[model samples]
Target chain A: MVEQGGGASGAGCMGCPLRQRSEWCVLNEEETRFLSRHLKKRRYRAGETIFSAGEPSHGVYCVASGTAAIRKGNAEGNTVLLRLAYPGDTLGYRGLLLGENRRYGAEALGPSKVCFVDRAVVKLLLERNPALGQQFLRRIARDMDEAHDHLVRNATLSNRDKFIHLLRALMNRHGRTATDGGHFMELPLSRRDLASMIGARHETLSRIIGRLEEDGIARFSGRTVYVARSHWLLNDSRPPTLLD
Target chain B: MVEQGGGASGAGCMGCPLRQRSEWCVLNEEETRFLSRHLKKRRYRAGETIFSAGEPSHGVYCVASGTAAIRKGNAEGNTVLLRLAYPGDTLGYRGLLLGENRRYGAEALGPSKVCFVDRAVVKLLLERNPALGQQFLRRIARDMDEAHDHLVRNATLSNRDKFIHLLRALMNRHGRTATDGGHFMELPLSRRDLASMIGARHETLSRIIGRLEEDGIARFSGRTVYVARSHWLLNDSRPPTLLD
Candidate 1:
């Protein structure tokens, strides 16, 4: 049942949400029709395994709805949530593009819909339209640039500061909210998941969140967190000493 | 000085390195002839600033010889040396590609040679052969991939481990040599410069290097660092901890 696919391919391209600005979304209708015929839509339930690290391969999948998480673990079983992918993003594609069989595991964060495009299909598309391939290349390039910059910042900054900064970044990307305290934007992660994303233990993340609340930097009610002062979190004014 | 460029633009259908791989490198023989007609090489002394971050646009410089240290700094003046660029690598092309007037500074780590291709010329090349544009896109993609991975590793690892892992990575990429009690790699960077490259303070870097030596991890003499046990350094052997 695991390897049973929907069909030979060609399903999710036309009327796809990603068709708006994604590389697959061609400027011309003729190109779009050509590509649509090569895409296929697939669905998965929440908590379903999309792909495992070190597994064979299924080519790349373009997300249409819901969310997915990329997670990697060390030999000791310590896990790190690499990224929380959303709509319009491509998942498990980096490996195919890089020509690697596998590197990490990907799972649906919730009931998600994805479009599967096989390697052969991709090659055919490239052969048919190099310009579209060029657009795909650019999209990956942008993702790479942002990912690298984010890593440097994470490595250099302290746990709490990084947590706050990540919150700020996600807030900007998703949506911003103006609250009486300052700006409170909801995070799309569990406490443990947030901890793993920032390379801290679950307890450490909880402690830091508690400390932030006590310091009036942020507040939390159940799973929801409210930022009391966004400016203080964003600016390094009188920065706190960081000891690792 | 910003707009001062050739009235003619550079296009890809001419003789460009990108022509070798795909249409992206489409450099026709005639355009190649014209470049040879006007091409000139420039040299710089070691420690020279070729172009500082925020400098106005001019043209892209392709590394012709020696080496160039690429770096990006934060608002706090802390820098992250992106990479040590060498011959055959293009230096400072991102701004030109992104349409940004300026960002990121380029400096020479040693006596370096470079060929400056006018921005106008590149713009021309892009127009004639969109395929050739793919080559430039590929380069950016590679850079982004490297930077992104580096950031991810740095964010997840501790400072001491990050430095050790960084040296291992460097040794692999640049090659290393074995000595009596340890291994030595041609140290491409001074302590301050390396600290900048690895995103650490100079003092912390110095202390960490000393600690690494004391724990049979490595020995530093002037610019050369001979890691006592290179294999262990490469591995995450948490049992072998360095005493403070």
Candidate 2:
């Protein structure tokens, strides 16, 4: 929660890698200059909460380094991981835009540095650039679509199918090419975290992973999972063609 | 699926009740007049599909009358009910705003009349009024928040809690006050649809409802349901307090 402003010249917004690659950082020269003036860089330790649910929406955070977990809780006080956000990803725009309390909480998965841009500054930028506003709108819309897809999957898919889909999604989101002509993903969390993300019990997750391994779909050792054959998984990930 | 643009004058935007009540219709007189010029109204029969997933996003639809079900198919090719769109509610804005294909399919719950506004015209209106753009942004943000809440509920809440919470939500959204100090809800769909919504099998849903009746929490008869009390349901609906 500590804010470190006026450090853009040091290790902050100046020449940040996310500016060149992140979709949310698609800002023009003037916009970038404005960000350099207002963005505050905050550092967080692993597992430290960046923001909690019901907190006022004062600003947004762009993860400059390390990863973050976005989580929500139910009526029974159990928290579920909604999504894992990676470096260069933006967070908290929903609360800022909606003028509501935060619906989910975010925590640093590891030592991370995130740049916080004030809500007023962000609104001013949107007013000056409608395209920027549209970009953010598109991002939020995509989030809603993903949530809907998750709901459908949870309600209808078998546990095995859900497990494979989760791996495929993780591969697509944060995979690296393995030397053995396969995909490898290094998740920031452990099996328990993955189990929570896919809404499966730990023993059930283990049983399914064993089954998938037997079926030659994917293999996991430690936090790094290797996918030897992705064709079936990829095919399974294809949403049923809507009867248009 | 049928296009009848010029027939708008007979059943369209002119004198539409939604224009007065919908937050999406928070436009100046000038924008309202513009809507009158370009919006087309269409009628759909019960059980008829309004739009399917993967359809190109050309415009947005506002439910003028009747109700519609928004659904998405799971990996098993079975469709799940996502939510219901009622009069004064807008649909398809997610795809339209994101410039992506429609993620969910919509169909008439009963006979529904919905008005369509062209994407080009909507964009023009947004450019003309930034406040209107903010309103839409806020609406989309709220939608994302609700989606996150749903994800958490599905993952963390027990089956009984989930069922009760869904009823409370439906009652809050579309219930009518009964004469006997209870709440009455006339769901456009049947028990099967309700079963799909709560992700419960028909037999399990029946058992839960019977249990609730024994507890004197609620009662369902045909298409109408009556809740003898709401305070307990409302109290149960509050999300768990997040551990900051």
Candidate 3:
């Protein structure tokens, strides 16, 4: 069933991982209590949209578990995968605080649980707590920095370099080093998602992956991937010039 | 002589155009007074850098007059013009508030006057006034949105379309409608600066502008450009299909 978004109670927010982690969501005692009162948990299945573009923002959603993709469409109507949202990351705060409609859509990659807090409480907390406002500002600034970097990369990097960059980013986030020292991981996104991320077509992505496998740089079986040449993928001193 | 940046008196913040206009800068009476005490004016000549990438941000710069370009470099070390900061726009707040090094450099596009407010006082004002915090948040959100839009344009639009889009943006911001109903504007930036904004080489930009002039879509005599065929450039219904 596609849970189309509504108030669905899942768990308490008193000791939620996002709240407990100072590095992730820092909420003081009073602010935490205030947010806890308005917290409502919601779940989504694989390929479900947590929110859509142009929709009114109710509040921020804190992801508790599972992965999701932030997607936006270009002027030519081509979809681009902006970034992936992981556990402990908050979403929708940008639109909510700015009082603007959603510019991008958030879609779940797998079974995901997210806690939503109302905008009213958020505004109140921001007004009352200067530290929390600063945290929000920092988070937004980091996001802006990442977006700017992506713009630069999209313009400068070749499709092959971009794929390697994306793979390395995913590996850093979700890879588990095997006994043989090769990093292995199951891709959370499909080929189409990966292509959108690298600003390439799905067929192009398939061709690139096939070439990488043939060259012994990467190995993929279904959604599972192993970077045989992790060093090459992450080589910063001198990158291999792979022509597209 | 290059102004390496120092305290220079230009204008008072009290009753300044930015502060007097609610839509521009939203500071309350008390907050404005507090900011006025610490406000130092600085003026920059054309091609002067107000701030640089990787530099320590001392405070926020509120543009009092004239326009400036915000620039950043890509991974390949190519300079990209990120944005144009106009009068009433605030720069360096992102770095100051986040306590991070400047990600992009700000350079005056023409003779520009800017008011600098110390970060310590800005923080104090933010804490004391919730509206000021909200205003900053909105400004940052808008910047993020514009950056995202630029990313999408870079990925999808053809070079010709991108140039037209750039022209349209400039015309909207700084153009004056002439007697013949055509938008007339002085190009604040040189071909090099314009090229960087659209991720194109300076030679390519020159060629495109030359073609536009030859085709009667635009006329450029040195720094002065007259867009005679503004309709052609601003046509949303159908875009010229130019092969890259």
Best prediction by DockQ: 2
Give the winner by lDDT: 1 or 2: 2
Tens-place lDDT digits, model 3, residues B1-244:
3121223333345567666542236666666666766766777888888889999888898787899888889756888777888888889887897788899999888888877777887878776766777788888888888987887777666667788888888888888888888878787778987887776788999998877766667788887778764453445423332421
C-alpha RMSD between model 3 and the true structure: 4.1
DockQ (C-alpha based) per candidate is 0.29, 0.66, 0.59
Ranking by TM-score: 3, 2, 1
Error of 2 at B57 (Å): 1.7
lDDT (Cα) of model 2: 0.76
Clashing pairs counted in every model: 19, 0, 0
| Model 3, TM vs. native | 0.87
Q: Per candidate, chain B TM-score?
A: 0.79, 0.85, 0.87
Query: How well is each residue in B11-40 modelled by candidate 1, as lDDT tens digits?
Result: 322433433533223456665555444444
After superposition, which runs of candidate 3 have C-alpha atoms over 4 Å from their true positions? Answer: A1-11, A22-25, A29-34, A229-244, B1-11, B21-24, B210-216, B230-244
lDDT of 1: 0.65
Ranked by lDDT, top first = 2, 3, 1
Report the lDDT tens digits of candidate 2 across residue range B153-199: 77766567788888877888779887767888886767777777767
Write down the worst ten-residue block by lDDT for model 3 chain A. A1-10
CA shift at B139, candidate 1, in angstroms? 4.0
User: lDDT for each of the candidates?
Assistant: 0.65, 0.76, 0.76
DockQ-derived CAPRI band for the predicted complex in model 3: medium
Task: Tell me the spans in candidate 1 whose CA falls farther than 4 Å from its real position.
Answer: A1-12, A55-58, A72-78, A173-186, A229-244, B1-40, B55-59, B120-138, B172-182, B229-244
Q: In model 1, what is the error at residue A75, expressed in angstroms?
A: 6.6
